[model samples]
Target: MDWSTKRKLEYFGILVAAILLFVVLPFFIFIYKPPTCFDGKKNSDETGVDCGGSCRLLCRAEALDPILKWDPRIFRVSLGVYSLLAYVENPNVSAGVRSAPYIFRIYDKEGLLILERRGSTFIPRGKTFAVFDGNFSLEERIPAKATFEWGELVWSRTTVSGPEISITNKALMREETTPRVEATVENKSLEPIRDLELTALIFDSDGNAIASSRTFLEYLDKGGEAEVVFTWPQPFPTRAEVCAAPVDVTLVLDRSGSMDDLGANPPQPLTDVKNAAVYFVNLLHEKDQAAVVSFATEAASPIESVLGRNFEAVKRAIERIAIRETDIQHTNIADGLLKAKEELVSSRHASAASQVAILLTDGVATRPEKGGDPGYPETYAQQVANDMRQSRIALFTIGLGKNVNESFLRSIASSSEEFFLTPTAKELRGVYKKIAEKICTTRAAVIEIIPRIYPR
Candidate 1:
């Protein structure tokens, strides 16, 4: 209790502490350091190698890989310039990566790798974010396919919520010349949104993405709106000839004795002809009207009394067609042409629609019996075709077999190029599809609409 005794005891305690720091502690540390999360090894309370249990690196198995809502896509921005984009989905709640490395491989029609784009992006949390690379030039090569791959990913814990932006008043225009997609991007949140990137995708009526463009928004005040327009320097590209105008087409098919020359009961070329006609009908635009006009000894409307937008009905009518089994079964090309012209001029046909008649025959016109002239049927068919052509009816004539008079068929077509020659029944579908593309295929639209934002 005295001052001197207390001083002596204090000095002894100080000596013991110095020995532990300089000697005892060093001995224990030199022998072995206890397992820690920072050791880069799976030890201690960690679940996987240096991950979880107070580690910054998250366990890869516990994380969800981003989804590919669609494959990588390319859109032409100008003559040879293109924009590459893909939608990556990160659904992990309250988690994201600071930087994500990605690679996109663009392939041509032959499946050869034409271009490879590599970039890094911030993985926005719990949303479909876009990976975009602009100003990519493929010169004259057209991209037919693209593939995406992810690089080494290191996910960390974080929270991210994208800017509240809404797209409205979307309109697509100038698709035939230079494609344009305009839309208003409005910031819906009270806070101003900064560094926003917008993408517009043009979709065809069939919902297939045909085009895409990228734009940047540096900043937008809360409740502010900005009109963004996407323009492509070139008119949309199509693999086949397409009609931009509305169409009203009639399939004037021959259901005569020659069509069933194979004697298969259901028929050979006729059966194939029906299938081709149905394919053509199914390819028509939603507003387009199709009529089935079949002729043996005389023309008849297989659809009974209507030519409208009901393509399935028209297809059914074409399927129901069979070769006329009557004793006077004859190929009446003139009657078929007349019947098609009548159907095209019907009230069911839209006033603005382009009137087209696809005339297919497997044999020479044998009707309107030439008592004196063997060429009478051909002359009569050409006269009827001339009348229809003068009435503004475009004709596409198909000579389906060796028996068909190619010269007469060519004369029936509105133009020489409108004539198609099919050497076999199996080749009819391709011919029909080509014709359908001429009248029915729509312009390319954007592939998808995905907006990504960067807050920092």
Candidate 2:
């Protein structure tokens, strides 16, 4: 064959091949299936229907397209950890479709599949429809850009329902450290969440899913409380401030005759107690609250001092304690400690960092008038100390005079180490100074460290 004849024959073959490829390639490249609601959107005569088009994407076999339409795709979402949520619009026709099950899926930033779920609904006739509550973890190493796709939504002539789903995640701070988070889940729907499977996904600073927990429970009701707690799997880069409770302090003063003695030192023994108590009160932070109680024959009072933004008010209350004894009979240490504890525990701010009762005495408890009498000074101090302990109020005792019963004082304090037995009146001021230091040194939060391979 000649060169021109060969070229003409080759060109004819190329034209036929191009025509065939154009017809078949598009069929695979894009799907052009009829809208799920196509038939339903039309009239009885099968006309005037808002079938597949950009204007509206639904049509029904039975019902005609109403001027106004209801959006069939509806859903709600919740979170168990920090997560990302989104939605997508169906880009298909609008006929014979009542509702279509919206398949929700989560993908990592790298386009890896993480989770998927299909909502319940039948595609009905409408101009517009929407799918909601597409949720994924913020912990999933999200790439710069991520995408979402719905599963094949089918048209169903019968009724279909949607599933109740939720997504939760831990909050991440600027440093990308996992935040301490607590979650509560309640079954507010009419139906019970049977065999509910819940998992909490915790993320790291780099947006990676690091830790997870599966929670199991019998059942959750409308008003039920299911508390789930999660912490960072790795230690935070920097330590955060710990939250400590406030302090509840009750000052118990000695009002016996010996308390009236002037100390060899510049400040009298009683004055030292007053000075120490006032200084401690002055040191109280905005979070700390204090009260005063004094005893002579019996514990006479729990005088409430106004809560101090600063310590000035507390000092005023302490200095105002009456030097006059309620009764000149004898010291009733037990009555005083007990009365002080009762008042402290009943206080609104009782459950604080340091729950303390400070007992100051310049003399021993009243000696027993009768062997079996329960009102003896030793018996009263012991009984009161024991009773205060049962109430969980920690006691710090201050003994001022040489005659002060060291052993008896030990028994009244919550802990022997917390008790202070000053051998002479000269040491009373130092005792108060020490007490103030102890109260202020209390830590903000209860911290007990347990060694672990990796913290979670």
Candidate 3:
């Protein structure tokens, strides 16, 4: 009786299990759902809506910061019109933003806000791309400082790639007052390209970027080439003029006993000063001329004139200036200025286009009287500075260390910007470099943007 009952029960259980597997299992399979990226729900392993799990796009919080290589470059297009360019890099190989808000602010030399441009542009993925703005007009203000900043962006996975454009046969023509740049742009991509933006930057012989221009192309067929020209309304200074333009620069350095003080980080004030002076000499253009004058109680005589092309001679002259160890530790600024003036007027460089005097001192003017009765040395130096200005020679003054007279140095300089205060010898090289840059460059009158399009 037990065997027969057990067999019947087992057969009944098997029938029940088969019915559940075939019918009920199919009903549940048709009704249930799994998580997906496009479902608009925070399901699956996603950190945010449709991003940050296995999705290619990243959430805003997970994105890395954008890298700006340098400050935005502003070019003066005309009297009041300007052009701006910013180079930015996106580190994420897969992340990008279609558009990002940006602000370009222009400030005057005194740090006064002049104008600001607010705009948005496409931020390409991966590699560096340039953000450009043209024809920014300010009624009468001249910009001295320009800054560019980007607003928050939503990063997404992108398939956008740079257009395959190659530049060839680039030539800069300076025959006219307006300089022109000729270049051929080739499109190597399989598809036709349109509305391509191109920019050209003009650098001086010293590798200082002086001017920039931008142009656009309407269309380019695949494997086609088009010639484009960028011309400035105002002719660039001729290469001959740039190379031949004469500049007379005289460096007046203080070699007083206090100069031997261990003020610099390595405690080498005199050596640092010599190095800085040599660096300044090296920055001069080939046609420019330089002179060295050192003073303690009195100025050095028999001023040696060194051509900029003879950089080694100038550096040797600078290194030869030695600190005075005598009882007279007085800073005879008047003697130094007088000697510099004499050197400038006597040298053939008197006819130079720009004559500049750079006076660097570590202490106050102590000798009011070089030989006569006691007189105001500071006043005498100021008068000499005025006379030099009247002669069309610009004067720049650098006050080093804490004992220097800022007011006196400021009075000697042609303008506020011409006076540099360096509390330590470590900054002497940078100051000298700045002065050299100012002396060697000329301001461009106009920057022109010419756009030409060729049909592929």
Maximum-TM-score candidate: 1
Clashing pairs in 3: 177-235, 178-235, 232-448
**For residues 72-145, what per-residue lDDT tens digits would candidate 1 score against the true structure?**
77777788788887877898876777788999999988999998999888787787777878887899998888
lDDT of 2 by residue, 1-456 (tens): 999999999999898888768875677567654544355555333334644333243233333432212222111112332322222222233343443344545555567765555564333332232232333344434323323343344332322232233323333332234445455555545554544434343333223333333344455554444655544434333333222446687788886667666743333666767876776665555667777777777666445453223467666766766555354647777777767767776745445456778888888878435577754768766777787777776789877757877887877777788888776655666776677667665332211111001001
lDDT of each: 0.80, 0.53, 0.77
Q: After superposition, how far is residue 397 of candidate 2 from its true place, in Å?
A: 1.0
- Give the Cα-based TM-score of candidate 1 against the true structure: 0.56
TM-score of 2: 0.41
Q: How far is candidate 3 from the true structure (C-alpha RMSD, Å)?
A: 16.3
Worst 10 residues of 1 by lDDT: 440-449
- How accurate locally is residue 177 in candidate 2, as Cα lDDT from 0 to 100? 45
Which residue pairs overlap in candidate 1's backbone?
A: 201-446, 202-445, 202-446, 209-447, 210-445, 211-445, 211-446
